[model samples]
Target: MKYHFFQSKYWVIVWSIALFFFACRDPKQNAKENVKEGELKEPQEENAHTTVIKTIPGGVDTPAGMVWIPGAMFDQGAVAQDQMAMGHEKPSFQVAVDGFFMDETEVTNAKFEKFVKETGYLTVAEREIDWEEMKKQLPEGTPKPHDSILQPGSLTFKKSKSSVPNLYDFSQWWQWTIGASWKHPAGPNSSIKGKENHPVVHIAYEDALAYCEWAGRRLPTEAEWELAARGNRKDKIFFWGDDQDLLGNQANTWEGEFPVMNTQQDGFERRAPVKSYPPNDFGLYDMAGNVWEWTGDWYNTNYYNEVSSKKQLLKNPKGAAKPFNERDRYAKEKVMKGGSFLCSESYCASYRVSARMATSLDSSLEHLGFRTVASVDMVKAEKN
Candidate 1:
C-alpha cells in the first residue's frame, strides 16, 4: 500500500481515549497511585474536561531514512560545567514541548528497497555529478578532480591489524568506496541480500528527503530531534541518564580495539537491529546509538549562542534563515544528532544527549538515518 502522512483524525481518536476515562475519575488520587507504580499520572479534572493518559507503542519498523522519537522536552544544548562531558551540547536550556508521534526505529535496508521499487527513484548518489556545481563552490585552481574521484559513495572503515603498540592508525579504517549506495552498501560488488533488517546507510540528505516525501513524512528539525532523543531529561550525559554503564550490555557500538579488532560486545561490528537496545523514558529506541540521524536544521558551530541570545520563546526554532559556510554553500549541511556506532570515548566521543554535529546535505553514509514528528494540540491532547 502507498504511504500516507499521519492523519489528524487518528490523533483525535487517541486524545478522546485519554479524556473520556479521566473525566469520570479523580486525577489527584490517581496521581498518587501512578507515582507508587512509577507511572506518569494524568492531570486531575479541574474543569469540565479531564486529562487522559495515552500509551504509544515504541520500536515499530520503518524503511530507510526514518526513526520514531516520542515527543517530550528534556534539555536542549549544554552548559560550561558540562563542557568536559559534552562540549557541543553547550548553552543548555529547558525546552517545553508537546506530545507527538515519532518513528520507532531507524529506516532499514529492506524498507528503503521498497521505496526504490515502488517509485523507481534514483538517489542523489546514482545521478551524474554536476561538474559546474562542484567548481562554482571549490577554491580557485583546485585542479577539478576527476569525476571518478567525485563519484557518489560513503566512507566505510576497513578492519585491519596494527603492529605498533601505541600507534593504531584509524585513518586506514575509513575508505571512500565507489558505488557504495544503499543498494550496494560495501561498494559495487556488495548487496543487501540477507541484510534487509540492517539500517540503510550511504544515503545523502536529498536521498532522505525523497524517501520521507514518499513516506508522507519529513526529517525532524534539530530541536525536535534532540528533544525527542533526550526524553524529558535535563543536563544528562547519555540519553538514559548520567551513568553511561547503567546497562552492562553495550548498545550498538564497537567494543574492543578501535577499528582493527571489535569485541562485538554489542553483537555486530556494523549496524545493529533497530530495536536491539532499550528505549528512552519517552519510549524512543536507538536515540543514543546505532546510526546518526539527520535533522532539517542547517549546521552552525555557534548556533547555540544565537539561541541563548534570543529573548523570544523559540517555540519551534529552525536554524539560520539562509545557509552559510562552505558545506552550506554547496547544498547546506544539515545538523546531525545522536552519535553513531563508530563513536568511542577514546576517539570521537559524541554519544551524549546534547551533542550535535553536521554533514554535507548531498553526502550520505552507512552511519546515518532519520525520523519524523507532528505538533500536538494542547487542548486536544489533554482531552485525549
Candidate 2:
C-alpha cells in the first residue's frame, strides 16, 4: 500500500474519496473533529457585544456595484445562541475592520467572462493537472494516479435520486467531472449560456487572486468578510436576525432533503443570479448563502483560539501563515465563508453568519465562488 498505493483499486478508491471530501467537506463532520473529548465550551461573550457605529464615507466616490462597509468593532466568532456553531468557529473575540468597498454580490459569470475575454485567462479547473505539484499535498512517497484521472476538471455535485444513508461518504454525491470549469459548470455538456448573472463557479484560490489583481481589488480577509457579511448586525447568528424561520426567504439554500431533493423554495436549486435574494442590512446580497465565498486567509482550526486569547481588539488580522485542517492535514486549505445553496439544516447548516468551511487551495467546485474587496485607498488610486 505504501509503495504502489495509486495502482491498487482499493487505494485508488480511498484516494478519490479522500479528494472528494477535501474538495467539498462536510462541515458538520468537521465540526465534530474540532472539539476535544469533553463537552465544548462556546466562546466567552465578554467581548461579543458591540454597537454598529457609523462612519463617514470619507468623500471617496464609491465604485460601481460596490457598497461601503463602515469600519466597526464586533465579535468575530460564534455567539452563545448559535447551537449549530462548529468548534472551529469558537472563542468569539472582538475584532475591528477598517472601511472598505465590497462587491454587492458574488462575482458573476458576466464579470468573470469579461476578465477572461480581456486577459484570455484559463481558470485552474481548465488547466491541466500537475501531479508533481498535487502530490505535494498528499502523503510523502504516494504514487500518482493514472494519466486519465489527471485531466483538467472540477468537482460537480450530482443530486441523488433517492435518499442516501451514508452521508459521511462524500463521494456518493460529488463527482470528478472532466471539463467542469466555470464555463461548463455541470460538465462538458453544460454551458453558462443564459446564467451570466449567476456567480461564477469552479474558481480556485489562485484564479480568484488573478481576477482580483486584474481588477485592482483583493479578496476579503476572514475578519473583513465576517464584518461585511454581518451587515452591522449585533450578536445575530444569521445576517437577517436570530430567527431561523427567515432563512428560506432571505437566501438560497437546500429546502428539502439535502443531496436527495431541493424544493427550490427560494426559487433556485443551485446557484442563483446575483441579487436573487434580499440584501442584508449593509446592502450586500447573498452574503449568507447562494455560494460560499473565498476569504484571503488560510484555514487554521485554532486561529480563533489565538485571537480570543489576545484579550484585545484585533485590527484587520490576517489568518494563519499556513493552513491546518485536522481532518486533512496534508492538504493546503483556505477559509470559505457564507454557505452554499447545497447547505441544509440536516447537513452543513452553514448558512449561519459564523459558519465556516475549508477546502483545498487548488480545489474548485460548482458551489464555490468569491467576491473581491478594495480598500478606500486602493479605490482612490484606481480612479486617480
Candidate 3:
C-alpha cells in the first residue's frame, strides 16, 4: 500500500487496486489491523450498547457541517463518453440510493484537530510498523523491511525536475517521508499551524473512523459518494455539471506537466482550503478535486461487473465485503473516489467523476483524505 496512479484503461485494474485501496475499509474491521507499537489507540464507542434508531424530531434533518443529498437513480459507472473510465467501471449499472447527509467538503484540518484533541488519538502514520500484524496483509513469504526503515511515515509526492515520457512507474514521484503525519503534512519541517481550513491529509481509515465516531458520522458508501459527487447532474464527464478545462485551475489538479512541473495556475502547489472553488449543484464542495475521499466500500476489480451481472437495480450499495485484487489475490484494497489534486489528464485522468482508485487499507498519502455521512441508520449499525 503506497502512492500509485493507474492508467485510464485496462491498466487501471492492476495498479489502481493496489494503490488506491489505502485504509477505506470497514471502520470496525480496519481498527483490528495491526499497527506498529504505540501506533494505535483503542477507538471508543460511548453508546455501543445502544442500538435504537434516532431520527430528527421532524423525521429527517441535516447534520451540522453536512448537506442533505436527495436520493435518486443515476448511472453509477462509466458512461459511453468517458474515455478515462477504468476497466472496473464497465457494465455500468443503474443504482438507487436513499437520501443521506454528506459532508460539504473534505474534513478540514481544524475539524480533525478538534477530534484528535477530544479523543487523544494517534494516527497509524504516527507509529512504528507492526511487522507481525502487517504480514497478514501481504503474501505469506514476503520479507520484512529493516526495522530502522519501518518507523512511522507516510507517502508524499515529489514533483520531478523535468518532464518525462513514461507515466507508468508511479513510484518515481511518490516517496515515503518520515514524520509525514497529519500534523506534519509534507514532513517534519512542514506544519498545519495556519492551515486549519485545509482538508486534512495523511488520513488512514482508522483515523477517519475515529473522527466520524467522535462526530457521530460515518464514511459515505461508494454509491452514495458517487451520487453526491455527481451533484444530481448524471451523465456529465466531470462533477462541475459539465466538462470544464481540467488543464486549468477549474479544480485543484495538475496543470502543467504531471509529476514534473506545475504552474500552480490555481495558486496552490499543495492543498487548497476547503471550498476554494464553487460548490456543486448540491452545495457540495471539493467533490471532484482536492483530496481523494475515502469511501466505505471494499474494492474488488469485478464488483461492479458482478452487480451488473445481477441485472437488478441496486439499492444503496456499500461495495464488496472485502478487497480482492484479481492480479494479486493476496492483496487487499478499498475503493477511493474523487481523484486527488495530483490527478492529471496526461496520467491518471481519474478526475472524471466516475473514475475510481484503490489501494491497501493501511496506506496514507498527502493527497488522500475523506468526508463523513450522517445517516441515522448507519450510526445505529456502527453502535451495534
Candidate 4:
C-alpha cells in the first residue's frame, strides 16, 4: 500500500511541472486571449451621432487659439482676382480632407503660461545667444563682441513716434530687444502676471515646439492649416466667404489710421480675446483675424503652382525642400497662415484665407501666435 501511494505522489509532481512549463511557453497567447475576452465583453463606444452640429463638452477650453474644425475639404487656394494678385495664392484646387479637430482661437497668454509653469521650460529667445554660431554666418570683419548681436534677445517692435510716417511698416513696429521673451514680453520689466488672457507673444518656433510636445499635439502643417481656415466652402477670400466685411461687422484687424491712431473700431487695438467674434460655417473661430498662426511647411512661393500642376489629390502635402527667398534664411522660419488683429488695408492685408507669410523659427512678435490641429478620424455628416 505504501509503495503505491509513493508512485501516485510522484506522478502528481510531474504533472504540476509540465503544467508550469506549458504556461510559461505561451504567456503571450494567454494575455491575448484575456484581451480578446475583455474586448468582447466591452466593445469600444462610438459617438453614434456622426454630425457634429453641436459643440461638445471638453471642447471649450482646449487651449486658447485652437478652433475645433470639423474635417472636410474646401478649395485650397484663391478663387478671386484679389487673391490671385497676392502672387502665391493661385490655381485653386479642390481639396478633400478627413475630418479632424482644430483650435477655435489663437493660443493665449494664459494657456501658454500654464504650459510653461507645468514644464518649467525656457523659450529659445530666453536662452543666451551662441556668438560663435552667429559669427560663422557673418563676414570675417563682422563686429564681434557686439552688444546687439551677443545679447540674448527676441523681437519686440518699438512703438514708432506718432509723427513718423509709414508707421505701418513692420520694421517700425518690430524691434529686437534684449531679454525680450515670452516670460518678459516687453523685456526685463514686463511680466505676464495679469496678462494671462492676452495672446502670448515673443515665442520662437522652438518655444511653440516645446509647448506642443508637452500638450501631446503638434503645429498644423501648411495644407492642414489652410484647409481648416477655409472651412467647407470653395477658396473664398476670407474664412467667412468672399465678402471681407459681412453684415457691416468687422471681425478683426486694426481700423482708423495705421500705427499712429488705432481707431479700435473692431473693439480691439491689440490681440482680442479668443472667440471674440462669431465662428465660421465650420465652427472655426478667428480664422481670418486675431494672430497669425504657424504651419509646419517650409515657405516656397512656387509650391502652390506645383500642387496645382499635379492635378491629383495630395494628402497632407508638405512644401519645398528649400526656402524660396531671403525672407526665410534660418530654415528655422516656417509658413504662418491667416492674418492678425494688427492687419489693416493700409498695412499688412494677410487676413485672406489663402494669404501666407513666414517668420524666423527663433523670432517672435506681439502679433504672432498659433493654433493646433489633429487628423480627422471619422466621416462627418454634411451641414444643411
Candidate 5:
C-alpha cells in the first residue's frame, strides 16, 4: 500500500502533494493563541530546575557509533508556550524510558550502501510500483496509470525560483522524481559520490527496518526519540534551550525564505554531513534538524490526548496501535521527528524538541531519514 501516486495521474499527485502540505503547515495556523512577534513565553520558573537527565555511561566495549541514554521521567510533549507548536504536539504527558544505546547520528549513506551491497536490497524508491497495491489507497474505479509513469522514484524537493502564492500547495516544490533513491538522491543525474558521510535520505520505514535487522538494532520509539532529542535540557523549547535565537547557530534549518531561498546561515543549505552541528548534551547529533528521523509509532493526531487522559506516568509507552489522521484516512502514517533543512520560522518550525509530524510509512522523501537504537542487553550481546 505504498501511496506514491505520481504526476501522471493528476488527481493522485495532487492528493499526495496535499499530504505533504498538511504535514508541513504554516506556523501561523499552528498557534493556539496569537502572541506578539519576537516574544516567547518560557516555562514556569519553579519547574525549570526540577528535572535532571541521568545519563548512564557507555562501558569500554560500548556498541560502535552509539551512546548510552540513561532513562528518566519527563514530560513528553511541547513546552508551556511554544508558539510554533502544532496541535499534534499538544497535551504534554509524563512518560519514562529505560536507558538504551542510540545511534550518535542518522544512518549514513556509506552504511546504507554497505547494507544494500551485502544483501542486494532494493529500497522502496528503487522498487517498481504495483498498480493493484497502490489502488488500495486510491479511490475506487481509478484507472491504472501507464506502465511508463509507474517507474520507481521518490519524492524530491525542487526549490522554486520565486515565492509561490501560498504554501498550501506542496506540488509547487515537491516533485516525484524518477530514479530518486538513496544512491541517486536528486534523481538519475545525482549521485552520493561525495555525500557518503551524510545521512541516507529517501528511506522508507521498511527500508529502515531492513537496515536495523542487519545491524541488530531497531528504530527508536517516539517516546525515546523525544527524550533523546530533549537531551540534558528539560522542558525546553529547542533541544539546546528555550531560546529560538540559537536555532540558526545550533541546528541545520532554513534561515531566509523557506523554499525560494535558504540564507544558509547555519552553513548548510541541504542535508549537512552527519554531526555537522554540535551534538546534544547526551552526545546525540542531528536530533533536532538535518532531517526528519522515523520512529516506531503509528501516528494518531489524538494519541497525546489519549495518553494525557490516563493522568499517570507511563513507563516506556508505545504509541497508538493504528494510524488515524483525519486529513487523509486512506494513507497510513508513522511518526517522524526533528525537522529537515526545509523547516523555517515562516513555514513549519519542526526543529523544536516536541514537534511531531505524520509521514506516510511508505514515503521515501529527500528529507526523511532514520537512526537506530539498541537495548542495554542488546549492546552486551554484541560483545559475545
Candidate 6:
C-alpha cells in the first residue's frame, strides 16, 4: 500500500523533474548505484592495460576533449566522517583506481548537438514513454497512465507563489512539462541558443551512454568518479575541502532559501556554464556542484559494508548487484554523484563530495547531466 502511493504520487513528481530534490526511481533497472544494461560498451583490442601502477608516471598519449586523471590511493567517501554523512557513504574504505582520462567539463549542448546532428540520435526525452515499459517496474496488473501523461517530456523544477510550499509534497516544485529536452530545457519555448556552453540536461543514463558511444568514451565508475572528483584530496568534506565558503564561490549551489526561493546568491538561478566555477586541484571543473553526475554503480545502502568487508586494497570496485531503496522499494534508481544547481545548503546540500542522489534511468530532468571517462584499456586501444 505504501509502495503504491510512492509510485502514484512521487512518481508523478520525480518523473517530471528527473527528480524532486533527488528522490524516487525504478528499483530494478534504476538501482541507485548501478546503471542498467546498454550503459557500458564492449572494450575492443588495444585495451591492454586497465590498471596502471602508481609508480609509473606520465608517458601515455593524451586524448582530445579529456584530461588525464592520475591514478591514486585514497579514502573514497565523506571526508568529515561524521554523523551528518549519509549512511550509504559511511565506513569509508581505501580504493585504488588506475589513471584514466576524464572530460574537462560536462558535456555541453553544442557538443551533444554535434553528436545528434551527425548520428541523428534522438534522446529518450524526445520520444513518448510507453505504458508497457513503465508497467514492468510497477506491481502486476497495474493500469497504464493517460496517454498525455506519457508524452515525450522530462521533469523540471517549478516554484510556486506560496513561498512556503509543502516540502513534504514535492509536486509544488516538480512539474512534468512537455517538450523539456536538452534542446528545450525549461519547456517547449525554452532554447539553448546562447547557453550552448552550459552543461546539457534532460539526459537519461542511456542518453549519456549514447553520447559516449559516439564520442568513443564511457561513463566513469563510482571509484573513478570519486577519485577524479577528489582530485587526489581524499576524505575532504567537498572537492574543495571542509570550508563551505572555500574560494567564496564554492562550485555553483543555491544561496538563499531552497524550493521556495533561491536568492541566486551564487549569481545563478539555475545552472551556470560548465567551468563557471574554479577547477579542483587536478584541474577538473565542476567536480562538486553544477549538476548531479551519473556514476556506474548500483544504489546500495550497504555497499560500503560490502567494500569494508573486502578488507584489502580494492581495485576497480564495482557497485553492488542491484539497488534497494528502502523508502521506495518499487523505484529503480541509479547513483547521482555531485549534486545539482538546485542544491541549497538549507535544504538539499548534496553538493558535498560524498553526497549521493538517486533517480530512475528512464527519467530526465533540467538539472541532471553527466560527464564521461575512458578506461585505461580503451584509451590504450584507441591509441594503438
Per-model root-mean-square deviation over C-alphas? 16.3, 7.4, 8.6, 21.8, 9.0, 6.0
lDDT by residue for model 5 over 195-308, one digit each (tens)? 999999999777898898889999998899998889888788988898898888789988897589888989988999998889999899999888899998777767888777
Q: Score each candidate by Cα lDDT.
A: 0.57, 0.77, 0.71, 0.58, 0.76, 0.71
Assess every candidate by TM-score: 0.72, 0.85, 0.82, 0.74, 0.85, 0.84
Model 6, residue 114: C-alpha shift (Å): 0.7
Model 2: lDDT of residue 72: 87
Give the higher-TM-score candidate: 2 or 3: 2
For candidate 3, what's the RMSD? 8.6
Query: Per-residue alpha-carbon lDDT of model 4 for 224-334, expressed as tens digits?
Result: 788777766645677677776671153678676555667777787776777778877767777777777877666655667766676655544555554553332323246
Tens digits of per-residue lDDT for model 2, 1-384: 000000111222225645422222221111111323321223333344443424535567889999989888888899899988878888898876787889999999999999999999998788776666566444567666778777788878898989987676666677778789999999999999999999999987778988998999999988889989898676999998899898889999989986898999888898889998899988999998888899987777668886678586666667676666555454456789998898888777888898887765566788899999998779778878
Residue-level error in angstroms, candidate 3, position 299? 0.8
For model 5, which pairs clash?
Answer: none
Cα lDDT of model 3 by residue, 281-353, tens digit: 8899888778998887776776877777766666666777556667556545668988778877777777678
Off by over 4 Å in 3: 1-59, 134-146, 246-249, 376-384
Estimate, for each residue in 1-384, the C-alpha lDDT of model 6 and write its tens digit: 001012232256334534333335442222133245532322222222335455324456667878888887777777654435766776787766788889999999999999999999888788756566556554466555556566777778887666654455655677778788999999999999999999999988778878888888988888888888887567677887777767238778766666767777677888899988888887889887787888767666567776666555666666656666667655556677888777766555777777776666766788889999987678777777
Highest lDDT scorer:
2
Candidate 4 lDDT at 300 equals 58
Superposition TM-score, candidate 4 onto the true structure: 0.74
User: In model 6, how large is the Cα lDDT of residue 350?
Assistant: 74
